[model samples]
Every structure is written in structure tokens, then in C-alpha cells.
Target: MNRYPTVLTIAGSDSGGGAGIQADLKTIAALGAYGTSAITALTAQNTQGVRAIHPVPPAFLQEQLEAVFEDITVDAVKIGMVNTVEVARVIADMLDRFKPGFVVFDPVMVSTSGSKLIQDETVAVLWQELFPRVDLITPNLDEAEILIGGQIRTPATMKGAAIQMVEKGCRAVLLKGGHLVGSTIYDVLAQSSQEPLILESDYIESRNVHGTGCTLSSAIATYVARGNSLAESIIFAKEYIAGAIRSGADVVTGYGPGPLNHSFSPVSMQIVS
Candidate 1:
């Protein structure tokens, strides 16, 4: 019997159903992969902002990871929004144990309000523990700035940051340049073995920009699970996210930023031998 290509998302939950675990599942399903999750925290949030966050106990989180890994054949993993040091450590440990074929980490270190979400110590721990375990790390401009302790104002700096992150132990880095002031968004993919690739897309003018990072990372994981190369997966994920944003541009889900239309182009669940 064949099994559906599965991508497990280790992230937080957003009650708004736009980002985090919600968006990850949506993207995985849309891209023809079965999705599983081990939630590290739950946030009371909406399109506007986060209100409160309740951490899942480390022991329970470990149990969730064990349960999924023991039963499911997770082909790829996408990680997001790990705020606490304890949660970060648990995820790193689980990755070491299960050794999933592909791992993508979206270093969600900053909030929409331009505030640091994780502490300095937690950041160090992520670099120490998780950076060496994952295949790719996707960080938006703000998060990249935080990680490198410098501003990224141009494409050159973005590429430089990606290289710096790869030197820090990530196998590859996708430095998202969506926050750059322009109509064309630039995402730089830098790997240790190849020349940096620049992916460009038109900036869709939409309030429905929430969950894009989660959605993109999940899509990449699904594509990788389905046997696409790392660069190919990133290309496909970028296209998928651009389409989702364009499709949901006019829809209104909340007064603030809304969500991408993840199902705009859906595929049947892919089966693997």
C-alpha cells in the first residue's frame, strides 16, 4: 500500500485560522500532502494582533512529538513560531531523534508590531540546536535583521545575510525580501553548495497578507516531500504564495490583514511508494 506524502508542522496555533498551524495545514493540503502538527503554543490572536499566548508544557509537547513520529511516516517537517527556549529545545531534540528527510524552519522571531517575539537567549539556543538540524531556514527581512544584527536595505545585503546564516550552520537560507520598499518582492535563496538564486514576484496590494510566511514554508515542505529538489520546492512555493495572495486580494476576513486563499489551486493528495 502507498502512503500520502506527509509534512508535519511544529508550530503554534492561531485562533484566527490564518497563520501558524492553521495555515500550515491548509498549505500542505492544498499542495497535495497530508499534514500533521505538534503545537508548541496557542495564541489568542486575530488579524489585528496577538492578545495572549499559552505555552504547551514541554512534557506534553514531547508526548505529541512522540505520538506522531511513532505512528506517522512524516516525510518533511515545517517549523514555525517557537517562542520559548523549552519549546525550541524539545523540537530540536525530536528532529535529532526522528531525522525527518526534510526540515524547513521559519524563524518567526518578530511580531507584526516590530517587536521581538523570542528572547536573546532563545535565539542563541535556536542557532545552537535547531540551526544545525534543519535543511532550510526562512527568515523575512525583519527577522533576518534580528538574526544578523544588521539592517537589510538592498538586494546585496539580503544575499549577504543569507550567506551569513548558511555559515551559521543552516544548510540553506531563504531570506524573504517582502518588507523591502518596492513593488517587486525579492526572495533570495542561498545554499552552501550553489550560487544564490533570486526569486522575484509582483507585490500584490492586499490586506490579506497574514500567514504568507507559514503558507510558503508549508508549501515548500509539501513539494519537497513530493520529491522536488530544494531549489525547485522554493520556486514552486513562491509561485503558490503569489497566486494565493493575488486570489485573496479583494476578500475581507478581518479589519486588519487577512489570510491568503490557500485553496485557490488545490491538488489531490500525492501518494508515495
Candidate 2:
């Protein structure tokens, strides 16, 4: 019997189903990997905005992690929206213990609508503990600025932030240029051992990009779980996300910004049975 590549997401739940754990699971399944999840928080959210957030206790979060690690051999992990310092500590401990082969972190702080998802205190712990454990971290411009305690206004600044993040112990950093103002979107993939790689794509001007970050990170994890090299995985994930964004361009889900086309095709979930 052939075993399927498995990817796990430890993230918050989005009731809107366009982002967060919902987007992660959809992206993983769409990429032919077995998707699993351990929800860290539950948000009553939609395209309009986040109405409420309920964080799961650290002990319960640990229990969920233990249950998954005990039974399933998780090939890769995509971490998102850790709401508290305790939750961040629990995740850091788990990373140290399990030592998963490939870990992709989306340091989700501010929402697309400009609301903070993680606490200020937890941000420090995330940098000191969880950030160092991941194989790669995917952060938007706003998050990059928060991580470095400065502004990232240009490509040069983004590169500097990525380098600093690598110095902080992450093996590599994928600093997104989506938040920058321009017709062209540039994403930098930098590693300590290699020169920075720039991925430039034409900006798809659409407000329906609710879960692009979560989707991209999850797709990268899925590709890694399927044995793709780091560079290759990120490139493929970018292509997948770009397609999803374009596919869902005009469709509106909620009153505010909508989500991507995670279920755009049946081929999105091509499991190896």
C-alpha cells in the first residue's frame, strides 16, 4: 500500500471558510496531500470582519498536538494564528520535542482588515521560541515590520528584514511584497546559505484575497511533505495561490473582501490512494 504525504496545520478557524484552518486544509487537499488540523483558536469571522475570537487553552492545545503526533506521522507542519504567549510556548515545546522534518510558519498578526490577531506579548515569545524552530517563515510586509520593529516600505527594506529574520534563527524567510504599493508584486525568498531569490508576478488587483497568506504557507507545507525542495516548493505554491486568486477575482462571498478559489477544481485534492 502506498502511503500518502501528510501535512498538518495548527491554526485558528475562520467561520468564513476562506482563510485560516479552512484555507490550509483546502490548499493541502488541493495539492494532493492528506490534511490534518489542530485548531488553536476559533473566530466568528467573515469577509466583513472578525466579530469575535475565542482562544483555546494552552493545555487543550497541547492535548490536540499530542493526539496527532502519537498516531499520525506528520510530514510537514504549517503554523498560523497563535493567539497567546502560552499557546506560542506550547507550540515551541512541541517543535523541540517532535522535530518535524518541514515546518512552515505564517506569523499571522494583523488580519487583512487591519485587526491584530496575536497579542503583543506573544509576539516576543514567537520570535524567541517558535520563529527559530521553523524551516521557513512567510510574513507579509506588516508582519515583517512587527518582527523587526521597523517599517518595510520598499524591496530593499524587505530584503533587510528577511536577512534579520534569518539571523534570528529561522533557516529561511519568504518576505511577501504584496502589501507594497505597485503594479508588480515581488516576493523575496532568502536563506543564510544562499543568495536571495526574487519571485515577481504581475499584481492581480482584487479585493477577494482573504486567505492568500494561509493558503500559500499551507501549499508550501504540502509540497514539502510531497518531497519538493524548498525553492521548488515555494515557487509551486506561489503559482497555485496566484491561480486561486485569479479564479476567485470577481466572486464575492461576504460584504467585505472575499476569499480565494480554494475549491476551484476537483484536482485540488488528488490524493494518492
Candidate 3:
């Protein structure tokens, strides 16, 4: 039997539906892939910020993973918002067990509203156990700063930090530069023994920036799941995100930041050999 390229998102459920697993699934589908999810936590969150979080138990989380891996051909996996290090450990163990072909770990450390999402110990396990196990790790400026133990205040520092994350076990790192104050946003993709890829784009003046990171990584996973090379995946995902941002720049969803136009133009599942 034939199948669509499948990508699974292991993440928190966003009640607002603009970010987290919601955004991940939307991004995956929009990018022409079948989307599945194993929700890690429940969040009382909206565009303004995250209010509360309830983590899924480790055993239950494992069951969700098993449910998907047993039946689905997960071509790629996107992981987000695992609150506890134990949960991360469980996810890592399961990944080792199933050997998912491609994995994108989005280290969602803090919310846009300044909420701390991960603890120190959790960070330790995430970096030591999970980062090395995945194909790529996508961290925004703040997350990269935390992971690399330095300031990523400039584009040069951001590239340096991406390389540092590689040294800390990431097979590849996409150190997002959206947080920096600039006219052109430079997202650095650092791979082991490869030249750092500098993805530059003019900043789209849009406050509807919720779930941007989640969407980007999910799109990458989707393209990778569709048999695209990692570099091609990154490039395609970036273009997809830019379109999403531009399409939704003026649309109002909530009182604060709005969701991206993931369905700006629906495309059928892309099957590549």
C-alpha cells in the first residue's frame, strides 16, 4: 500500500491553536505531509502568553509514542515542549527503539511573553540525552543562548552559538535569529563538518508571530519526510514560513499575535521517489 509522507509531532497542546502541536500539525499538513501527534503537555495559552502547563505522565507519553510507531510509518518526527527531563528521556528511549528516520527537536525554552518553559535539570537531560539523538535541533536566539551558555545578541554570535550547539551533541543546529534587532533576519544552519548556511530574509513587519518556530521546524520535518535533502528541506521550509508570515501579516485572530496562514494555498501531498 502507498502512503503519504508522514511526520509526527510530540508536543504540548496549545489551547489557543496558534502554536505548539496545533501549529506543528498545521505546518505538516500544509507542507504536503500526513500529520500525527503525541501531545506531551496541555497548556492554557494564547497569543499573549502561556498561563499554565500540565505535563503528560511518562508512561502515558510512552503509550502515545507506541501507538503511533506501531502502526504509522513516521518518516520524520518533530519534538517540542517536553517540560520534564524524564519525559525527554522517555522520548529519547522510544526514538532509539523505533529509529525514526528524521527528527527535528525544537527547544522551546521560553515563551514570547517571558515565561520560563524548562527547568535546569530538564535542560541538562534535553541537551545530553535528546539533542544528540535527533537529526536537527532548532533553537531560537534565547534558546541558543541558554543552551550554549553565552549571549547570541548578534548574527556572528548566533553562528558561533550554532556551532557550539553542534559541539554539544547536535548533529545540526538552526539557530534562529528572529530575536535580534535588525532589518534582515539571519537564521544560521550549522551542520557537523559543513559550512554554516546563512538564511537571510527581510523582516516581515508582522505581530502575528505566534508559533513561527514551531511552524518552521515542522515544515523542515515535512520536507525531509518527503525525501528532500536536509539543505533542501531547510530552504523549502524557510520559503513556506515566509509565505505563511506574509499571508497572515494583517489577519487578526486573537487580541495579540495571530496564527500564520498555514493554509494560504492548500497543496496536495507531495510524493517523491
Tell me the TM-score of model 2: 0.96
Candidate 2 lDDT, 18-91, residue by residue in tens: 88999999888888889889999999999988889999999999999999998988999999999899999999
RMSD of each: 1.1, 1.4, 1.1
Q: After superposition, how far is residue 199 of candidate 2 from its true place, in Å?
A: 1.3
What C-alpha lDDT, on a 0 to 100 scale, does residue 159 get in candidate 3?
Answer: 81
Off by over 4 Å in 3: 271-273
Error of 3 at 38 (Å): 0.4
TM-score of each: 0.97, 0.96, 0.97
Off by over 4 Å in 2: 268-273
Cα lDDT of model 1 by residue, 1-273, tens digit: 899999999998999999999999999999999999999889888888888888899889999999999999999999998888999999989988988999999998776645455767888898899989999999999888888899898999999899998888889999999989888988999999789988888887887889889999999999999999998899899999989999999999988889989999999988888
Better of 2 and 3 by TM-score: 3
lDDT of 3 by residue, 43-119 (tens): 99988888899998999999999999999889999999988988999999999999999999999989877888887
What lDDT is reached at residue 260 by model 2?
A: 88
Residue 209 accuracy (lDDT) in model 2: 95
How many pairs in model 2 have backbone atoms within 3 A of each other, for residues 3 or more apart or on separate chains, i.e. clashes?
Answer: 1
* Colliding residue pairs in candidate 1: none
